[model samples]
Target: MTNAMWTHGVEWLTAATPDPRAGERAWLPGDGTVLMEAGRHWDLVSVPRQLGLLTLDILWYDPARTPGPTLVDSAAHRVGFLVPPDPAGDWSGEGVRHASRGAWVAVPPPHRTARSLEWIVPPDACTALHPPVTLRLALREAYETLAVLAPVC
Candidate 1:
């Protein structure tokens, strides 16, 4: 992507925060990351990194379409998939959970990996949020691919 694309991607990430201006301000100073609220512009579906990576593999192989922005915190061993807020209702089950509404997540710049906060699937497009239904289907498929519905987190 071009510089414009990178800028737009960062814009996309910051705009979703609870305070967009502050998010922008933080980015301007090259801050490592900005804390953004979930369940407004988007909701975060948190899962174990192992399963989340499998889910991403499933999404990429779909041939139809891949999932959207995914935030990874290696320090936390977690991956947070950004999707429309609570679209499928309480996602917490087994190895899955979600942060909605007031919950905050550290959002990194699209083109940079700040510490353990980075994007496995960086936001590029204007509407980078994933479709909830597709994400659920992929999660199910990833579990099936593992050959066991076991908890990873």
Candidate 2:
């Protein structure tokens, strides 16, 4: 199947501030937002306005029979996949893998029920990572495509 286009509006959760010790490693939220644009496939997105232009790309993964959604950020060099905990035992798959740091970061799932998952990559990282696209026009085209594909309820 051909790739699908999508647009999502995101807001910064924390104000951008300078870090005293780390030079400029300020924590600004809503970097690149990842969403499931298709069945079992996810998209890493960097919206416009924060940066000069918008950018997006699909994360490559090996298709599995029971694959949960996977998220990837080329800029961050991070890849994470959700693995539901087994009712009788602990989850088996790796949680978070930091490519550059050369380590596997184990992230425990929240105790509460998880309806969805979100991964935010830094906007600057995204800009540095992916090429730009005309987001407004893409969003409009995506809307039209969805309207055509929507099922009758």
Candidate 3:
């Protein structure tokens, strides 16, 4: 990856995990690990809940492709992974699971990790969900912000 690509990668991480002052909240456990496949990037985040845990995933894909939304079902509470537009591929469905506390689930094949922890985003605080169209733009903005803030970028 070029310097620019590395910058974008850093930005992607920062955009996914910002300070509480920047509206970044601890929605999940285990922090998160980023995945890059096809042409887009994904953050498998763990969010905790009373009943169970939730994985609040976010994807950044090209807007031109306009991919469809993906639905995920977990054992505890609701698990959702937003599928961003990408020509590469879709990382949704069958990937959702419980991430509450110390329990760790095996990471399915085609994914990088052998196993990972899961969690949920606190439902009450996450109200800034934009429409798909707007989210695409926000994704871009966050990427840019990350590029500017990242040290290695």
Candidate 4:
């Protein structure tokens, strides 16, 4: 079975971190890491898992204050591996579990590892982050968004 085509929207804000002023945020598609200003210090967010063509974890920085309605700026960073379904595997309703429109699921990786922490994502779930449009355009948009929101240093 072929992997379904899908995409997800970028996250605008990340969960609170240990430091109240600093956090990590994503500015581009396929970006494995990001740095953001938290007051006078810079914080880093790294990809914990290998990135795949289809799946990614949402990570972004949320500032304590902003001038306008935008509380969070820039595209969210993601970390995860892709696991498109095997063409020979069954895709019917035999063992398919009901998932939300954009939920992530843990699945066996294409290659086995001690971690065994791969994820399978539905096409619709990634619509915002990885849209049906060309990746170049999507990445450009993400970068522009980041430029506008990222602080000047």
Taking the tens digit of each residue's C-alpha lDDT, what string does model 2 give over 55-112?
1222212232222223343444444442222122221212211121122222111111
lDDT of 4: 0.24
Name every residue pair that clashes in candidate 2: 32-121
How close is every model to the real structure, measured as TM-score? Answer: 0.86, 0.24, 0.23, 0.23
- lDDT for 66 in candidate 2 is 23
lDDT of 2 at 112: 14
Best by lDDT: 1
Please give, for residues 1-153, the per-residue lDDT of candidate 4 as tens digits: 133221121222222123322322222323222231221211111121222121121122214311110111112223322122222322122112222223323222111111323223322222222221232232334445546777899
Cα lDDT tens digits for candidate 3, 1-153:
344543433344334322322212222223433222311223222122211111112333444333222222244333333333233332222322322223222221111121342312211112222244444443445445545766882
TM-score-based ranking, best first? Answer: 1, 2, 3, 4
TM-score attained by model 3: 0.23
Residue by residue across 124-143, what tens digits does model 1's lDDT show? 76544778778888888877
RMSD of each: 3.1, 18.3, 17.9, 20.0
Residue 48 lDDT (model 1): 90
Q: Report how far residue 112 has shifted in candidate 2, in Å.
A: 21
